[model samples]
Target: MNSLENFSKWLQEEGRSSGTIKTYLQIESFQKWWVAEKIADRFEPEEVTVLDLQDYKQFLVQHARNKRGGRLAAATVNKLLQVIRTYFKFLIETGVISYNPALKIKNQKIQKSHNTVRWLEDKEKIRLLRKINNPEGMKNTWHYKRNKAMVYTFLMGGLRVSELAGLIIPDLGLAKRRLTVHNGKGGKERDIPINDDLFQALSEWMEIRKESPDEIVFLSQKKGKFTLQGIEHVISKLGEQLGLEDFTPHVLRHTFCHDLIIKGYALQVVAELAGHEDLNTTRIYTMPGERETKKAVNSLSMGDSF
Candidate 1:
């Protein structure tokens, strides 16, 4: 096998999720750039230097344009740099490199205008659930139940879209009132307690769901496992009915985190439930929403008595 194939096997052995492995293998783009720039006569792992990485960073910032014809975002550049660092780390471990030259390099700073977490307000949540419960426009009762179960899993479980997609039959511990996320991001596993609503929805779906030969939890209408795009498309179509813009499963996830934090759940507890690798990510939920901020300011106003 080639070095890239070897690296992929190593990553799998290390329990990295498939998504992470795919992203890490994107180093091929860097290899192409290395050849195009004539950094080396050919792309050799041993010839890589910190200077070359620095030049590449400069290229990303000053020259690279995304598919939309805009400069690569700071976060995107940092993610690519992280991939480069990981590649070198693998090389060092395998004795192909003496050290990782990208060690001292820092990522570009990202500025925040406001909290980027978008979640449904209580009213929006109620409306969404009502639509799902009634689904008057939906003639297929089986799909309605399946979609409801999926949405509840997102809104209550705080599961990443990929994690939900990876769920299998045995992952649901209905009687125990919790579900196991065995293939979470970075391959970390965790259990999230199933609330009354989620449990009911899931139980109902399970009653009618046709058994998958692969033991998949959420099968598509065609009796195959649902693709990531298929899952997102299902949720997006629901959003359209509610007149919600860009309402994806991620919004439900954010709502799950935001609801728990605002209800006074401990930060550490929330972080673990959400499988957030960084506590700082969960802390974003603590930032008040626009409506909450407005309410806070309005509370100080003395009405007509003034």
Candidate 2:
């Protein structure tokens, strides 16, 4: 019926997940911004021009501020541009526009550094695992168990947060000592082995978890499925308690990959386990991180010689 409605249908037919569709539809904000800028009385896809897109890209780079009033990351800007480009493509396919105006715009370059991939150091991992493993004085035993299993799944299994949230009862193949990620990134499916530690943690949670008809692997005390934010909140609270700054699902995932690389696991093996489509993504772990760099520098320290 409407442009957005048609776009939604198109995205669904393209097999994009609901989350991805929602993200792509965030182009409404850009449309509103365009109208507010007095570029046109009303935002229309067919009327948009490449110069308008360039101006908008410049605005995003120079003016866009996140919720915290900080400049948006290059990746965030590029994601927005991607949404715009896709929406324009949709318009062209539907015969609403003659051409995709946003096509030629290039994404901002993202500099990769060793520090970019944040993972837990040995001591930090030990501290976090120790506390979660044997949480002393924690009153809510149910929450502790569920949260511990979540932490272990991230740390040991290398699952993305979305995959963890999407996990169902059938996905946990305890008999085979592995967990199936049925809905991994890009709808790919993979199985991660359930080592003794992860198996024990998951089993402990399963014993006390509330029964839900949805068969969700993890459930809230209210018998509802955990949302992405809900899962992050649980982990965030744990991070606060442990004094681990920026402790997140991705950090745990990085730690898993990094640890595997450090242990001499093949890049292909780590990529498959982590569901990474690219070996280059896995190879970043092979680079010397801050700890290794510090160790090398400290070895030549004048104070150490004295």
Candidate 3:
């Protein structure tokens, strides 16, 4: 009944994020298995059984190590499961699936034992910038300058890698202390303010940003468009070299949002600047640390020691 296409259409109509829609449609891995199992021939959604889903889950755990050289993480598996469950739920509501087979599937519990901030601290950020500016431990070359600018923009601007990659010179508002982010997550446009630090970095970069046929703000060594993967690779290598192993562009984004909250900025203001779809997402960054909570509780006055 072409349910997949119909489901995709529904997602688009519901204003789902482009990333979510894309992931749902990229179900080729599941489809390949279905085809080999002979279930791809005019498969009826209502005809599926719980046992069928169980078998597929097992197959994922057993044979899907080809990608990561190990079984997929529970979080990854759960994401795929959520998409299938939602698809079937949609089918049932639309009179496609008379019964839902994925109803019993449970989401995996994510381990949060680390309980550490996902973003960089102010001092670590300074170290990060220092490393990017002179990776060779000497002489800031042209590439080092560009690397510093790119990293600073992600940290201060809080842009998604894709958004950064798509940026052009025309989106800048250097004179006004902000930049217009075009085609961000969920196809939303946002204006993000840049502080004096970020402004100085960009000023240096613009001198060598180099006028060319490509209007993209960032460029690669090959004279082609900058790519998400390329930017990630640069950040990853810089982080490792600077002794901050898990650093990433998104970490910089998280740090940007976190710093705003710590600096006494209103939650709504941070939400708007970060372009979060929900205020609840912004609230997550404000969660008190264990140490902070302990200190608060201990501040109470006890009149007499028992």
TM-score of each: 0.91, 0.85, 0.70
Q: Tell me model 1's lDDT, rounded to 2 decimals.
A: 0.89
In model 3, state the lDDT of residue 176.
Answer: 92
lDDT (Cα, 0-100) at 132 in candidate 1 = 84
Instruction: Compose the digit string of candidate 1's lDDT tens values, residues 57-105.
Output: 9999989999999999898999999999888889999898886888987
Which candidate, 1 or 3, has the higher TM-score? 1
Q: Mind giving the per-residue lDDT tens digits that candidate 2 earns over 184-283?
A: 7656789899999999999998888745476898886677888888888888888999899998889999999999999999999999999997797898
Task: Using lDDT as the measure, name the better of candidate 2 and candidate 3.
Answer: 2
Off by over 4 Å in 3: 1-20, 28-41, 49-66, 85-106, 114-117, 129-141, 265-271, 275-284, 287-306
- Going through the candidates in order, what is the number of backbone clashes in each? 0, 0, 0
Candidates ranked, most accurate by lDDT first: 1, 2, 3
Candidate 2, TM-score vs. the true structure?
Answer: 0.85
